[model samples]
Target: MTTSATTNAAGVATERSSRRRGGLARPTGIPWILPALVVSVGVLYYCIGYTGYLSTLKWDGASPLQLQVGLENYARMFRDPIFWRALGNTALFYVVTFAVQVALGIVLACLLHSRLYLKTLYKVLIFVPVVLAPATTAPVFRQIYAPTGTLNTVLEGIGLGGLAQPWFSNGTFALFIIISVQIWQSTGVVFILYFAAIGQISPEVIEAARIDGAGDIRIITSIIWPSVRGTTIAIAILSAIGSLKTFDIPFLITSGGPTYATEFLGTRIYRISVQYSDVGLGAAFSIVLLLLAIGTAVLIQVGSRTREEKAGV
Candidate 1:
């Protein structure tokens, strides 16, 4: 009886192992990837298609009577002054943030890659802001820029009290504050990416440049810049997308206030959907935002590729 039981157990284990092998050795591999394929095609695209459908109707999110409005929402969006202002803000924000972050990130990354003192400490300091949540930091920024906050106090102590005023009350100043906050929070990510790209460079190539009497700036502009084109293109796409969907800091700090100066597509969408309870208008805005983000990324990528091909890069 004991011998017969051992033989049955061994046979069962062998059968299970062979079944596992057969599953992995399937030629098509369709079953292995079906879940992800379903998620992408089924869930993701279905939501997107549903949003497109919602954009064509006028509904208050919970109402059963969804009036078919066709393209009226899009037309209203185009004619809306606040929408234009938000679009302009996004454009300006993208340009300024992209330029400043690129310059600062590249310079800092290069310095850190060299024989700089306290490299590890500097790296930690630089990256800490990236990990900090915007929700937590937004209140801090609001207080600092408040009319009687630390900034004004410091200004008074330094005899620059004459320049101290309400920073967030003015439209232009509020927008500037938003831009500054974004740059502070996001530059660390840009720095890390540049640092990694720069690290991949061959030490021998940099040594050759040094031996050829190339200064730091010369080597950076010539060798390092061209080599990191891929990283820069990636950063550009990310910046474009982030700019299109800017909401957290602006909504928390300025609330897109001071006469809609800091309004963005994301903030507008939220206000329309929740505050106004116009889900259809919000859906239209969201659809446009999605298209713009995708289009901007494609334009940047294609433009970069075209330049590279033309220059034989």
Candidate 2:
């Protein structure tokens, strides 16, 4: 009896030791994760802080760039008329492009979602432009819109030579052409996004609406629209930000021709920094554009969140 009791006591001692060890081994947050996050944040802070410092100085990017001038560059930026013009042009591009792209994307998405023939072929054709390099497309369109280009050639052939005014020859028309190219290049992306969003929608819900005598238009308006409202908002916000920073297409096609007609902030910064050899002012413009982008993004997020809350409540 004593032998059995001693054995049971030993077993209890082992169980207590194991429980103590298990309790001690429980995780108390990782050491490496916090340090890595700190390093990442520090690097980001340094980059932004350095840019801000550079914006205040009058650095020509040569011969002592660390010199400070106390906001002279920023002051000059405010007085620059070209900056204001670029800002206005950017705003106009964003508004017009966002409206047209979203409207056309929804229409196309709805059409392609149906049981149409050649659906795969249609999708491939539509998505082809989205994958092409923007640089290649810019020059291609330039040829198409040039004075003696295919567009004018086609118009002349149709005996509509009067309709073929210089598409990119003048200031007003150059901006218009740039916007047109942007619309053409970007519409495919919008279509693909909206098409995917629509496909995610439950077919049962759509069928139920149809069975209840709801027409296609009615079902789209009452059901699909609400379901994809988040995606629509997201697309609008993305288009707005993208339009503001439009550079390569405009630069390659128009080169800010006809007295700075296509002078967006991006192109303007490049001209000042590279062509005129003024680094400080260009840095200031870069800072301004970054702030504008951040502000617009935040506003979009806030507006979207408010709408979501209202819908939920």
Candidate 3:
């Protein structure tokens, strides 16, 4: 009886000790993460604040002589035709790349999910482009689309030499190439996303749909597409953000133009800031870019939510 009483008291003390440890753990964790929080929130927000302040000044990146020009840089951006053209290009690029990549991704995802031969090899091949560096592949693509390159060689071999032209010589063609390159580069990511999303769908539901005389297209449209709508929304947001700040491919492939024909906001901001030394204008552009990205993400999310709410999902 004495031993039992003693054991009960010991158990109560251990429980109290654990409760004390649990209570202290969360407070102690803040100190451990304080350094990372400071670096991320403190240093990052400082740069953004500085950039906002600098946007009101007209100063060559190096010169100390500064003119205070409130919103003049922004006004100049509004009047700049190149800026509008870049904005238009971004819109078109987003539409084309997003549509093509999503469709291709969905198709590839379905195929990969099915019982196919050499599945691992096919996945690797499909994903290879996503892993490749744009800087390395840009030069290769430039050569291929050159006047005397593999594309032209293939065209001539097929007796379609008339269609063979220097693909980068024209603005239209350059824009097309940029869009195509973007679509090629990002499709794998979309495929993987859809693949994972589709995998989560209940197999029983699919089988039931098939037994109900639903064809492949019917099953895809009625069951699978709706199932992966969240993934599509996410891809839409990402594609919007990506298209807004696209630089590497267009810059590396064509240097933003045969005449600024393929310019995007990212490349334009870069050239303004570095090449022309228009730091104020560049800062303004950067601010606009940030706003647009955030706005787009919010819009897509809201639209998605509205649709989901209407559908009672």
Number of the predicted model whose lDDT against the real structure is largest: 1
- Model 3 gets an lDDT of 0.94
lDDT (tens digit, per residue) of candidate 1 on 204-311: 999999999999999999999998999999999999999999999899999998999999999999999999999989999999999999999999999998998999
Models sorted by TM-score, best on top? 3, 1, 2
On TM-score, the candidate that comes out on top is: 3
Clashes of each: 0, 0, 0
- Compared with the true structure, all predictions reach lDDT values of 0.95, 0.87, 0.94
Per-candidate RMSD, Å: 7.4, 4.1, 3.0
Model 2 over residues 174-292: C-alpha lDDT tens digits?
A: 89888888888888889988899999999999999999999988988998888788788889779878977888988999888778888899999999988988888988998899899
Report the lDDT of model 2 for residue 306: 95
Give the 10-residue window scoring lowest on summed lDDT in candidate 3. 23-32
Q: How accurate is candidate 2 locally (lDDT)?
A: 0.87
lDDT accuracy of residue 37 in candidate 1: 100
